[model samples]
Target: MTIDGISSTQGEDGVQEFDVLIIGAGPAGLAAGIYARRAGLSCLILEKGVPGGQVLTSPMIENYPGFPEVPGMKLMDHMAEHARRYVDIREGEEIVRVKGGERFEVSSGAGKYFSRALILTTGSTHRKLGVKGEDGMTGRGVSYCATCDGFFYKTREAIVVGGGNTALTDALYLHSIGCKVSIVHRRDSLRADKHLQESVAERKIPVLFDTVVEEIVGADEVTAVKLRNMKTGVVETKPVNGVFVAVGEVPSNQLA
Candidate 1:
């Protein structure tokens, strides 16, 4: 797959052009590849991480119709294979920046990939709790998707951090699945919608207001969280099994 005397080299400045360069290899990018190939255009998919993107982080998804329920990783694997049948799928190629024009040029870790059309499907990253062990053991124990890691913490206690809709939603879902959900927020007031607040209050979810997580305590897995009260300036620690960070999500639109 050498192009224009570039010798398929890495860190080269030469541009290798294609009819289409998809910036992600997720479901969206895979779908685009199917259509682009059917349209008889050369397509290339550049993905930074694993080919599945964030979808690989999900557990069992039941909402997607046609199948009763399917494993997220399985679905993504099938998609990647199907898309590869039509388009050239390149994984682990970090696209640093995109220069848009008549022929968009994508600068990657390898080299430049020029395309007549560019599909920006670079998704988002999960928000962090900034706590001690939280960042240290991201993939090991602390998780964003409950469905993915809930089974690992079955019958154990978990803490959800946030005062917004996402936090409340996570609490409700965890509570429904029989995990003791503790809602920890920094502010005394909740920024969630009124209806969502009502749901949280109605569910009798234990909420620690005006308090924030000072640090996540754990060795191999998250075992507890150190808490700090903003108003009283008191610090305390609560033993828990896991920490579900629901602060927010940051979209990966830097390449947009």
Candidate 2:
């Protein structure tokens, strides 16, 4: 069948062919599909999940050029819609294996596809705390993105585990939203920019230095976290309703 006026033919072996195959449907992948179609190349986008990638988890975005403020889901929806008008997008297709050659061969659970060129736009995954009860408490009270989960903790208590920009920013956001926030860093000092550190201090946010979370404690939901002081070797269980682990991110390049 023809998609977006680009001929997508299934060969006798049931392999769909395209000029360019994009392995993700995030901002970069969507943009690449649009550009490829505009250049008169037949393109296909294979996404394992829904479009939008990690941006979908963001609650509010103010840094985007045109709109003063927009929801992450809304912004990604607009981009995906625009891309659909130009290229063929196949969502829910996770690429399982890829073989390189004069023409790349890509395989998914459904079938195989061939493309002269391949674009890998896979994004990143959030790093986890790896502490006890963290996996079981996920979605019950554990979250990786503060902007995504901070709304649930307003007027409640939450702890951000990290000293980087993302962690400090999350703490500031939680505070602004009326959540009693604290910072738990394994290091003595924060690694965030000076401005963000100043903002945290200006807001008088409490930061626990040289501290690490040993375990997340809860029955159904998160009730507290077991913290260990590196210098003094003292262990304490701090009561909290939410645990926002923003240590860092690892690239989602397994398919590549």
Compute each candidate's TM-score over C-alphas: 0.68, 0.87
Measured with C-alpha atoms, the lDDT of residue 214 in candidate 2 is 97
Candidate 2, which segments miss by more than 4 Å at Cα? none
Clash pairs, model 1 backbone? none
Cα RMSD of all models vs. native, in order, equals: 5.6, 2.3
Give per-residue CA lDDT, model 1, range 63-95, as digits (tens): 577757787799899899998788777788899
Per lDDT, the best of the predicted structures is 2
Judging by TM-score against the true structure, name the best candidate: 2
Q: With candidate 1 superimposed using the best TM-score fit, by how many Å does residue 114's alpha carbon deviate from the native?
A: 0.9
Model 2 lDDT, residue 73, Cα: 96
**What are the Cα lDDT values of the candidates?**
0.80, 0.92
| Stretches of model 1 off by over 4 angstroms after superposition | 1-15, 130-141, 145-156, 162-223, 226-236
| Model 1 quality (TM-score) | 0.68
